[model samples]
Target: MSQKSLLLTAKQGSFAVGTTPIPKPGPGQVLIKIQSAALNPVEWKIQAYGLFIEKFPSVLGSDIAGTIEAVGEGVTGFAKGDRVLNQGTRGDNNEFSGFQQYALANADVTAKIVSSLSFDQASTVPVGLATAAVGLFNQGKSNSAGLYPPWEENGSGRYAGQPIVIFGGASSVGQYVIQVAKLAGFSPIITTASLTNADYLRGLGATHVLDRKLSAEQLKAQVSSITSASIQIVYDAISEADTQVAAYDLVSSGGTLVLVLANSIPESKRTSDRKIVNVFGNVNAPDNRATGASLYKQLTRLLENGSIKPNRVEVLPNGLQGIVDGLKKLQAGVSNIKLVAHPQETA
Candidate 1:
């Protein structure tokens, strides 16, 4: 059987709905019937900017939620009909790169989706939550028990009672970081968002919300008053020159900063004790599979057990055609919530 998909042919171009051969799962792989695919800013940016992908007619989504339709030889612990969510492949020809009705995902990258989460909600999670988890626990080493329970003692000694600031609190990534930081026992989780999103961010565990409109000095003062000690960990979900500069001022000596985007760090900004980290959102890279798998499993448990809630998703109609329109909305930035496109029909 063949499968239909929405393929991006070139930079800043419309997605073409086309049919491709149904891919069979290989060793350590599982074939999935995609239920919903979530759109991220990176999706449109990549399509518009045309970086990373080396070829045309590529499937671009990374956050995917679906059900297992087939399992390859040597794959264990998964069966047909199992609902799953995973970070899709970064390569152009990979079967699990998303934006398709059917995908073949690496078994290790797949995690059972929480029963309470809709496919849309599940689809919105893996990229943002996994990125936040890696940035906070793996890179920044923030003492949050939610991510690294075994490292609690180490994190506690380093970060307990210390303040951490997230520069874009209302973003899907920032919201998860706030919740994880709170659960890890970090105190005074501070963030920045527009006035409309201030209360929303506070509801998601933000101790303080700085208005983005505020002058840099005013923002700094607000953050300063939130913690007696200087901000020790900074996660920049929105990495612009101004935000980076403000984050540098917020951090004291020896504090760590993590930036999600791949912007270049200025030489003058380097400090002997301060470290700046960049997250590429590729948690499931071969070398980091263990950590990536563990985090996905933990996030699934957290969502299933209500330890963490799924982010809001704006759902469009189901079908491959709807996906192109949804991507346009994402590019225009008209919607505040994540946009999810369901490619399958449901009763």
Candidate 2:
């Protein structure tokens, strides 16, 4: 069977809408007729910096929401027609990525979405939530905070009264970090974003939303005034050099700072008491598979019980073709929202 896809023609190449054969599900996998595919900064970075993907004519997308069209052997608990959302491999597998109308997903990491969520909303959850969960809760890992997961038994509210700060609260990953940190009982959750996003972020469990425009000194002052407790964990979702510096400075001695991008802290400023962790957010990576599976197992319940919420979504026009422009919008910058496209609507 044939399907429409948005293909990156080469390294540092343009994305074009094209035809591709729909792949059948392999064992332990399912084929999804993708309804919504969300854009991420990494996808644009891949084009701009020629990163991660070495193969040409590659399909790129990491967040997908759709209905199962077929289930492969050995996969139970999921069947055809189930509404599901899963994170596609980050520039690793074309048939498994989200840019196509139909893509294969690992059953272990795919979660059923509740009827309450539209495809566009569900599409935003995988990457953002995985990045948040992995960075904060994946225990004993180099990329994570090594904290106990709140999704486990008696794990909820595990750190009540402890303060956590997240930079870029309005970014997709930042939003999830705020919510997950709340679940872990991090009280007085603080984040940096524009004033316009303060109320929206607060509703997502952030106790304080400082302006992202604030200078490093001003941000530190605002955070210090919010809580007298030492900040042990800081998640820099923006991961920009400046943000990383500010976030690292906020980490009390012996504390850890998580960055979404590569570490850029100068060696002169580094200290033995402070630690920086650069997060590799995709769950499909071999190291993160177990945690990814575990999260997917409880994802439905989490969504149904209102413990996890998706980002606000803006659906772009023109389906697969729409994503080219959507990536541009994401590259230019957006706040407090996820951009998504309906691949099936591609013309």
Candidate 3:
């Protein structure tokens, strides 16, 4: 069988809608007939810099929502026609990527989509939620704060009265971080974003949403006023050099600074008292698989109960082809929205 997919024709090449053979699921996997696939900054970076995906004619996407088209051997909990969402692996083979009409997802990290969410909303969950979950709760990892997961037994509200500052709170990952931090009982959850996003971020569990335009000094002063307790954990979802520096400065001595990108803090400013971890958010990665699977198990309930919410979505038109323009818009910048495409509607 054949299906339409948006292909990165070569490293640093243009994206194009093209036909590819639909893949059958292997053992422990299920084939997904993709309904919606969301774009991430990483996809644009891949095309612009030839990063992660080395293979030419590759498919690039991490978040998808769809229905199970077929189930492979040993996957018992899921069957054909079940609505689900999946986190596709970066640099994984084409059959496991999300840009295609049909892709295979390992059963362990796939979760059913609750009735309340459209495929667009469910499609926004995987990558953003995984990045937040793995970055904050993956124990024994430098990339995480090693905090107890709230979804686990006796883990809820473990950090009551503690404070966390998430840079880029309006970002998709930052939005999930705010929600997850609330579940973990981090008091006075603080985030930085444009003032326009304050109410929305607050609704997502952020207690304070500071303006992104603030200077590092100004932000520090504002954060200091919010909590007297040492600010121990800071998640820099933006992770740009300036944001990293600002975020790193907010971490109290002996605290951990979590970044979604490479550590850009200059050595002269770094101190032994502070630790910086650049998170690799892909759940399919060897280090994060266990946590990813665990999160998937609890995801449906989390969404159903409104404990975690999807980012507001803007669906692009033209199906897979629409993603080409979406990528450009993403590269230019967007706020408080996830851009999604309906791969099955490809022309």
Candidate 4:
């Protein structure tokens, strides 16, 4: 069978909504009929800057939600027609990427999408949630803070009195960080976002939503008023050089700060007392497979109970073709919502 896919025609070239052959699932993988595909900033960056992608006619999408068409060998507990969501990777071959109507997903890291959530909504979870989960709990000083994961024994509510200062609480990853941090029992979850998003972030478990417009000094002052405890963990979802510096300064000595992007904290300001970790959020990567599988195993329970929530999603029209414009909107900047495209709607 053939499928409609959004293909990057070439490096720094145009995106073409065209046809590609549907792929079969390999061992320990499942073939997915993608219903919804979410657009991320990295997808656009790859085309504009020729970043991670090298092959011609590559597919570049990460978050996907769909139903299983077939299951490969040894993939128990999942079967044909199982509703699922997973993180897809863009490689030289591009068969596993989510921009196409049919893609291959490793069964180990694909989570069942509960009845309460639509495919569009589920499409928002994998990338943002994985980034937040991997950065906060993945074991390893290089990849994360190595904090206890909430899914582990008594890991929930483990940091009762600790304070977490998250820069950019309204971003997709920021929303997940707030929810996961709350599940981990962090006290006084503090974040910076537009004042308009304060209530939304608070509903996600952030205790205080400081203005993103605030200067570092102003933000620090507001955080000070919220709790006298030192800020031991800071997750900078924004991770701009300026924000990273401020977040680094807020982390207590011997504590860790997480950045979603490269470390831009100037060497003049860097210190050894604290650590800064840049997160690679793709769970499908060989290195993160163990953590990814563990997360997928518990994802259904977390979503069913509303302990972890998908970001609010805005679905674009015309399926895969709509993703072109949607990426433009993402690049122009969106606030507090995920933009999703329906792959099956291609025409």
155-190: candidate 3 lDDT, tens digit per residue: 889999999999999999999999999999999899
- Candidate 4, residues 1-347, lDDT tens digits: the string is 88888999988999999889988888899999999999899988888888977788899899999999999888898988989999999889778899989999999999998889999899999999999999999886478998989877788999999999999999999999999999999999999999999999999999998888888898787888899997789999999988998899899888999999989888898889998898899998776788888888999999999999999999999889899999999999999999999999888
lDDT of 2 by residue, 35-119 (tens): 9999999988899999988877999998999999999999999888999999999565689999989999999999999898889
> Over the stretch 2-46, how does candidate 1's per-residue lDDT look in tens digits?
878788877666688777888999999999999998888887777
Clashes of each: 2, 0, 0, 0
Q: Clashing residue pairs in candidate 3, if any?
A: none
List residue ranges in candidate 1 displaced over 4 A.
139-159, 334-336, 345-347
| Residue ranges of candidate 4 with Cα displaced over 4 Å | none
Q: What is the overall TM-score of model 3 with all chains considered together? A: 0.99
Deviation (Å) of 321 in candidate 4: 0.8
Q: How far off is residue 216 in model 4, in Å?
A: 0.6
- Model 3 — which ten-residue stretch has the worst lDDT? 89-98
Error of 4 at 221 (Å): 1.3
Task: List where candidate 3 sits over 4 angstroms from the true fold.
Answer: none
TM-score: model 2 vs. ground truth: 0.98
- With candidate 3 superimposed using the best TM-score fit, by how many Å does residue 168's alpha carbon deviate from the native? 0.3
